[model samples]
Target: MTAQAVAATTRPRPARAWRAVLRLHQPALFLWGVFVTLVSAVLLWAYGPGGNAAGAAWRRKCTVDLCDWEDYSVDRYHFAFRFSEAAIDFMPILVAAWAGAMLIGRELENGTAELAWTQSVGPVRWLATKLTVPAALLTAGTTLLVGLHRLVFDTQQVPKGWNWSDNGTFEANGPVAIAFPLLALALGALSGLIARRALPGLIGGILANATATTLIGLAGPHLVPWKISVGDLKQGYEAPSGAIYGGEGAVTSTGAHIPDPCSGGEKACLAAHDIVGFYSEYHPSSQFWPLQLTETALILTVTALAVAAAFTLLRRRTA
Candidate 1:
């Protein structure tokens, strides 16, 4: 073979060429991304600075009672509702799911993989180049999301968003967090190599991603070593659903009164029973790193396994 031909066979194209691959997949990514931002905007707008109708009602009721004054802050409400965590949780899976379906599988379905492989590049290099764009874009998008979340939480007067307990950090680290969509992308890529059809690729990608997302979200904390505890009601105050004790002159059996604390009298101190100003025995803020590291490890492990499996499958098969 000519030296030029030999060089072409041995060396992969510049990674910058992968931009074409990323551009091809942008539409799929955009469609799924809307949901992530939509949910966040709705939740923040609803329960943000002036959005707490529900929280306000509960606080007002406490004013009539003798228990303690209820402090209502957007950050507290955001943490209570877990909106930021949900945004982080959903984005990766959605992105990966669509990519898996349309990018790898669809190309295979159209019998384009063979053509792609038969080009100047070999199968592996072609696949790598295709993946390069998506991977970079995914990393950029997620990092931006994390930054936005940090900005929102830190700028707020109340410390409401991005609690260590809510699984917010894990969502940003796509490689570690059972990120089903990313796995689906790999799976679909492999399947496209093996199955070679658009419909099947789409079906397989959707099913795999959906199932994995559900299973991971349900079983992740337990199957892996988890340091954060969710339902510890005994230590200080437990209100998962925002279960307020006192409101607007109404009294609970606990004799919990709300406004008595702010009533400008010594009576408020005595009435502030079961107020949620103390720490839970299993508080997450104090032990954030252990949980973060463990969960991050779990996610990265799963991602690595999936990528390995996909690579193995691709190596033996034609795309």
Candidate 2:
């Protein structure tokens, strides 16, 4: 039991384990996280309190014209969801999934698990540490992002909405939503193990996670425990520009503006009484916490399942 040997034996291998975890960082996932973070920051700055010079000028002009400066100003509540949509909503999940897929997928693909596990910590410990780093990073990153978004976007008049809550392209993939990302990472890690190629594993992770999100987003409303509806919240949920004539019920961005329709005055004259108000249809205030927690639970549950499966695969690989 020499001092040098004892010190070597006692040193924990967690750092190395994390290295193994991060070694799988794929270009796509890293880029996704970086791009989303940068974009969100820009959007937040643009829409934040007195965001841009033009916005300040508009507010100043509106204040001079209107009696109540506050009334004319586009406050947080007025553009809550829109700002959140641009700022901090759906990117975290993508980062999470990319990390998850890279976590075990890349190792499994290149058959580097054996080398990683040969360290003092066995395969299970190795995998656990690797998973921990990204999970921890994403959690910290997402928490900060969500908090920033709330500070900037959360408003009483307006509400905090999510890509999960909406049915638009902004709909979060697995890692995007807390619960969904857990499931997505699980699928991706598993996919990596089975597919064992970077591209295939990434695709597999995306497809499986996307399918799960779609199912949950679309069908979760109908199910129990996962129910996320805003009954009376729909009161103002009408399309921005009231209703469209001759083109289904589709409402475009312009319709939401509080002005007379420029549609040749045909529809304007017909529904002369119809005026677009600067109102938010999706009231996220009431359901913000509920939806966030629900989505978080889903991500955790899926993460648990994915971790279990990943360990099993690792065990089998090392066995």
On a 0 to 100 scale, what is the lDDT of residue 294 in model 2? 58
lDDT by residue for model 2 (1-319), tens: 8999999889564556556455555555476478548645744564554344435545455543443444434453335435444444454346435644566666666767666556566877866676566556656655555555444433222222233334321222223343443465567776677676777777777777767666666543322232222112124233322111112122334454332343323445424545333233332334445544555566566668777887787678668
Query: lDDT by residue for model 1 over 53-158, one digit each (tens)?
Result: 5456444544333425455443345553455557666655455545566777677667666776777656777677766566655555555555555545444433
Candidate 1 regions off by >4 Å?
Answer: 1-16, 29-85, 158-163, 167-181, 191-194, 214-283
Best model number under lDDT:
1
As a TM-score, model 1 comes out at 0.57
Candidate 2 off by > 4 Å: 1-15, 19-40, 47-93, 96-101, 155-179, 223-285
- How many steric overlaps are in each model, in order? 17, 15
TM-scores for all candidates: the values are 0.57, 0.59
